[model samples]
Target: ALQRTPLQHEQSDILEQQARDEKVALEKATDQGQYFVFCDTAPLLTAVYSDFVFGDTSLYPRARELHARYAMTLILEPDLPWVADGLQRDGAHVQKPIHLKIAQELRGMGSLHYRVTGSGEARLACARAAVLAGNTHIAATGWRRTI
Candidate 1:
């Protein structure tokens, strides 16, 4: 809706709503006993955007809480050519900066994240490898039963 609507990306109300939606979806996935719930971007990313665009940190606490529920986070690098995503994206130039901000935030939160980088099938392979590696780490650390 942010893409089609006139509402600005920095709008707090919309940001809050997006965070709430993410929380609800994550909760519902958990409630449904899903073994693996793949999220394109979580509330953590929403918090990143809130801070990056609006200088708002209001969503951090809740975003961090929801972030802890994830077994691992895959930070996909913006190495590929930018495809126009309507009004949702701020173009290719900002991709690296935004990605860095997200990495910094994840580090601050002490979250487990892997940077997935490559192109085409190689990128997918990298992500799959990361998932398998993360799963191994989770199992070894006895975090397997929780997810």
Candidate 2:
């Protein structure tokens, strides 16, 4: 199991205390990870629009430049059984069973790794099972943990 230092627990407590809602708390929790902020469709669209309207028409380029500056990987997750109008990108990974193979390819390409969570209540059950199984490291949609 991953060891959680007292400081880490304190930080988690502080984040939970300060968050306005559970979603905010979850995001804050994930922020504690080395590579956090895996962008989903909504945030990406909001960011694109914010930059396009208020900043520059070359906003996407500028954003990519900034991401490159920070050496951050922009990972796209469309969820499995891909839906139409979902976020599409050159390097985006589809959320289908076949996409598992695609994810392996991307991992080989040094893009990013991926995992599929079970559906509905099963998802939470899976997470709890992982925790019980002594899986210290975990990264999921709304939460991550090293404990």
Candidate 3:
């Protein structure tokens, strides 16, 4: 059996505590009047690489759980071609699996989600319409339409 080292255990504890604190703070900060709050990477892709590299999967579940619990997720297939800055990214072809992986993760969590696809204003409009329809009972009514 591969037992976790003491340092690994400590690191996991710290990460778990940080996630708990962040959730508490976010819950406290949410205003009753607010319809939504935005998170850039709602379903964080951080663990996709680290788990591949270091076998550290502690980050994935916590991020996924928090994202699903706190927000209505919108995943955009992004109309733009993937361009790497040469410093901060994996190539687009490489990232496809990561994107699909997150979607699969969210789907397994039974999350209500929207896949927004388009360019510029059209994309924004599609997201808006999806959200509105979702919030207004499309989820309940089973009204799936191609946007």
lDDT of 1 by residue, 1-147 (tens): 655423334555554565566566767877898656677767777777777766778877877876776788999998888998776776777788889988998898888789899998999999999999988888888874332
* TM-score of candidate 1 against the unseen true structure: 0.80
Compare candidates 1 and 3 on lDDT and give the better one: 1
The residue pairs that clash in candidate 3, if any, are none
lDDT of 3 by residue, 1-147 (tens): 124322334444545554565555556555455445555533244544445435678777766655545435787774578876645455676666667876787687776788888888998899998788667764575544210
For each candidate, give its TM-score against the true structure.
Answer: 0.80, 0.26, 0.64
lDDT of each: 0.76, 0.35, 0.60
Expressed as tens digits, the lDDT of each residue in 44-65 for candidate 2 is 2322433323442333333333
Pairs of residues clashing in candidate 2: 79-95, 80-95, 81-95
Candidate 2 has its poorest 10 consecutive residues by lDDT at 65-74
Judging by TM-score, tell me the better candidate of 2 and 3. Answer: 3
State which candidate has the highest lDDT. Answer: 1
Candidate 2 structure lDDT: 0.35
The backbone clash count of each candidate, in order, is 0, 3, 0
